[model samples]
Target: MRPVQRPRRSRRVLLSAAAGAAAVTVAVLAPQQAGALATAAVPVAVVDYDSHDATEYAARWVNPYGPLDGVVPQVDPSGAVTLSDVPFKPGTDFSVFDHLKYIGISTQTFTVPKVGTVTFEVDIAASTPGATPGHVVEGVYGPPGAWSLADPDARPYTATVLEGQQAGVVLNMIDFCTGQLFDWFVAGGSAFPLIERLPTSVTGNTSNPGCPGATEVGLDKAYTQIIKNIPLEPGQTHHVAISFSRSAGQSNVAYALDGQVVATVTNVGIPLDQQGNRYAWTGTYPSLGKGEKLADQINSLSIGHGLFSLLDAFPFQYGCSPPTTSPGAGACSPDSAAYSVSLSPAERSFGQGAEGVFSGFRVTTTGR
Candidate 1:
């Protein structure tokens, strides 16, 4: 999923007695046979959160054999971290993802190779009644390049200024929570992408994309297929499944939603630096070992969570201004920094809290 470019505020209301709600995820592992269908079987790091109680929701979600290296959930005294009717206000950048913990990733090391697909299914019932847009959003992120090649001191991929030869390839999933709702909520006012995104560098370029970010939340590119106008209702269980698959060096990416191929990207141009060395996922991009982990993770940009992944450790004065129409350089406003820092001490790990355990399972497969 591509990071949400814009986020909007929503109203919140108390629903039922907190206890959270029931949810389950079934991960279909890739088949072991080399020529088998891509969806056949998976072998490790599965995440099962359906049966987790309050305690499990807060902690104890670390799966050694699963794809996640850790899981950091945020809960309250009321119960599990159920979605609030109020808009899901994500933190700026890293805070969006820092609040989460990967299930099996102990270090910055990512085991998933550049190829292969990981497919999983889940049930999301709005814990509240009349669940609407911005209530509960979810998506899978590719194994993000855990370190910044542009700036050595920063953790995660903060070196967002990839002009040319700036660094390695970038990967991470964006929101796939509510297909239609996501499109409307985030891609509204824009030509909107049914499902697909361009690299940051190419976002403002008015070439093949042709369409501009004239409106908030819209994408310039659109795959051949899309699920439009579907609403996410509260208290109703929507069986949702998403598969994340990519080719070597990200030549292409294909995503299937609810068993249907929703988007396919055949040409994602490489963002080059002045040196012209292609910015591709290469050596060390997934080098963080079990003991080594980045300071934070990533979240959808539309809701304003994954901003930190591209920000400097401390807010710096962006020498250049940004375009008013585009989520360009000016996105690094001092106000943005202040807002993100406000969420300081974001949860990097859920060491202690009311506990809940995963009742669901994950199916993870890799080529490396």
Candidate 2:
């Protein structure tokens, strides 16, 4: 996506439109320092995505029998899912059957009051099951990366923001299974010299001690630090913050009440080890139009040790329609009924600010 163009600030004074109105009232104002308030404090909205509260947000899909079955027993209106199952044994796999058909469980959209950075606070807790000896579990989805609950060897997870129209720093929280802490300050999409990864500790500390448990990942070119990583104990709560801000190269993007920053990447210019480079790519796919070829967007933020991959499936927003027999048939066609969300000026403003910030909005499914 292209960077957002910032409007030029002018110093010329103009008369107020309501100045001459008879009903208008005036109040005294105090003078402030020049550079003191140079940076505006933008208002940010925090939406919690938990599964326990059903009325808060709407669910796109609900299944009591899937990979998340007894684990994530509840979902809230803010799109938060909570897992309370305990005694999570290592190497044990459970499934919430029939729920795999849907991608997102709950979703919310918010509007940006001003142009600034946006942050997300995600609360994750390991159940009493996870605290047991030999019990282990890993997050299958959410942000990016495969994090093990028991194994201390899994790689950290990565988070990134699509600033303006382009993706920004991809912050990776390296080896993060040890602590119950939160990370902070991931640069928004505007910063360049992109960040690929960042290293973090299980103790919720960003300081590097040069140990085997230290988590390492790739980032484009931004600074970030692990803030929190609360483990699941009996009645324990873990909170994490993924903050986003404007970098040097571009203007800031506005956010809606429902949007949030789930992850971030920190930049470490040098390679982590001598065996090979810190980052690598498998192959490139050609960009194609609707009828040409299908090219997937790059998932700059990812966790674990594997090449990024995209899944080919029916666009959920467009819903399933009658099957087609022609090449590139089915709902994949441009004229299919599967594309429900419009990118027009009116509909696109759901998560934008008056300053013309374009932080891109996501459409979530609601389970009736």
Candidate 3:
């Protein structure tokens, strides 16, 4: 849901495989009016390995808290991408106040018109094993700092944080897929969430019934709510899709996982340029759309895929190194055992493998 600020290299095994190309054509019909006849089918564009630039697609590290070990992406003969364990080597790991995991990102982007419906589809699996499992994200992003009106150039709510405005769906696959471990795995144990970017300008500043003026600053103001929660076993794969639709007198978004509609949002807002045109979805930032004008069109859409660490924040100073701290590390507590190396729980609990068997990544739009 959020992007990492600092990038540090960690020792990892480099496993390479050949890329495979495939394409499928799918046409979906638009919803018909009560009295109208039939609507035309919108053609779907399927993507393949060639669609992504080699230099841009790879597994990498994203440490938001502090220095820590990480893993890299591995492609198999079947074209499945997974994270290969980069065991902790003496000097390779960094000691920090806190630590997060790694991520594998796809650099390609899909366009989002100002109006009409657009759907993004992909298949994912829980290819990791451990108490905690890795998850994959499929999302639509807006301009950087779009949520912070006070400082559009600043990252969201603060200049120190490196996150932007985005709304998407997440799948946390934590099943134990082994036959002997079948009983430990829940039938449908994955958590499907419809996540959104918070409006930093009004979030902590809003007035409430109990607290009239709550201007407390908040970090990682991402609006995440579980629309559907279905568990899955390790190595289990599932289909996922997110659709955005906007037209005359209509505005909504829908999220589907494993062939079922999990969540829907109405009147969704996206990024726009100074001239009021929807920002075009591209690999680069500050890109604007040249299609329909914002006022003249219904809405906008964008797409992305990757595995990002679920970051955690601490409000006090505590770590193996006394006075250890980071951005927003408020104050030092009298008893600093909360962050001592011996007291802190293991941060990296999942094993290495494809976070999911990501495939069939494609988009279909009405071309509004």
Residue 256 displacement in candidate 3 (angstroms): 1.8
TM-scores, in order shown?
0.32, 0.28, 0.45
**Per-model CA lDDT versus the true structure:** 0.23, 0.21, 0.30
lDDT value for candidate 3? 0.30
Per-residue CA lDDT of model 1 for 1-368, tens digit only, reads 11111121110110010001100011122223323423454333433333245554424333332322232344444232322111122222232233222222111222333334443333222221112222212111111121111234332222221110110011123322111111111111111112223222223333324333322112122111222333333223332333344333332333332234434333222111111333232121111111111011111111111001111222211111322332211233333222112112222111211111111222333332
Best by lDDT: 3
Which one is best on TM-score? 3
- Give me candidate 2's TM-score against the actual structure: 0.28
- Superposition TM-score, candidate 3 onto the true structure: 0.45
Off by over 4 Å in 2: 1-43, 46-72, 75-82, 86-106, 109-115, 122-125, 130-235, 249-265, 268-368
lDDT of 3 by residue, 123-200 (tens): 555433222323321211112111112333332211111111111112221100100000001112344443333222
- Candidate 1 has an lDDT of 0.23
Lowest summed lDDT window (length 10), candidate 3: 14-23
